[model samples]
Target: MTSGKPISSHLLPLDPRRRRSLAWAAGLALLFPLAW
Candidate 1:
């Protein structure tokens, strides 16, 4: 379980990349409403 903790911590940096992608996707979703 201790070894797994480090691996999980390494994945924390990946969260930001995922968040940026999600933000872009959400922005695109909002743009459709404006266009309509």
Candidate 2:
């Protein structure tokens, strides 16, 4: 499994802005389903 995808690539940047945006998107997505 050593040849598999490297998770470090995704977590390398550690950008707070992108993370906050992603968190907002995720929160909205989760709340959207409840609206119906």
Candidate 3:
């Protein structure tokens, strides 16, 4: 296995929950553009 792939995969998971968190962040950024 590639060492880089193992390390990067740990950092960013392949799951639906991750997308939900990303969307939550975008919503927060839109609501508080200056704070983000």
State how far residue 23 of model 2 sits from its true place (Å): 0.2
Best of the two (1, 3) by TM-score: 1
* Winning candidate number (lDDT): 1
In model 1, the clashing pairs are none
Best by TM-score: 2
Q: What is candidate 3's TM-score against the reference?
A: 0.48
Off by over 4 Å in 3: 1-13, 34-36
Tell me the tens digit of each residue's lDDT in model 3 across 1-36: 686566446647657687567667767877897766
Error of 1 at 24 (Å): 0.4
Worst 10 residues of 2 by lDDT: 2-11
Q: Per-residue lDDT of 1-36 in model 2, one digit per residue for the tens?
A: 642235335645778787678668878988999996
How do the predictions measure up, each by TM-score? 0.52, 0.59, 0.48
Task: Tell me the tens digit of each residue's lDDT in model 1 across 1-36.
Answer: 586477557656787887577668878988999999
Best to worst by TM-score, what's the order?
2, 1, 3
Clashing pairs in 2: none
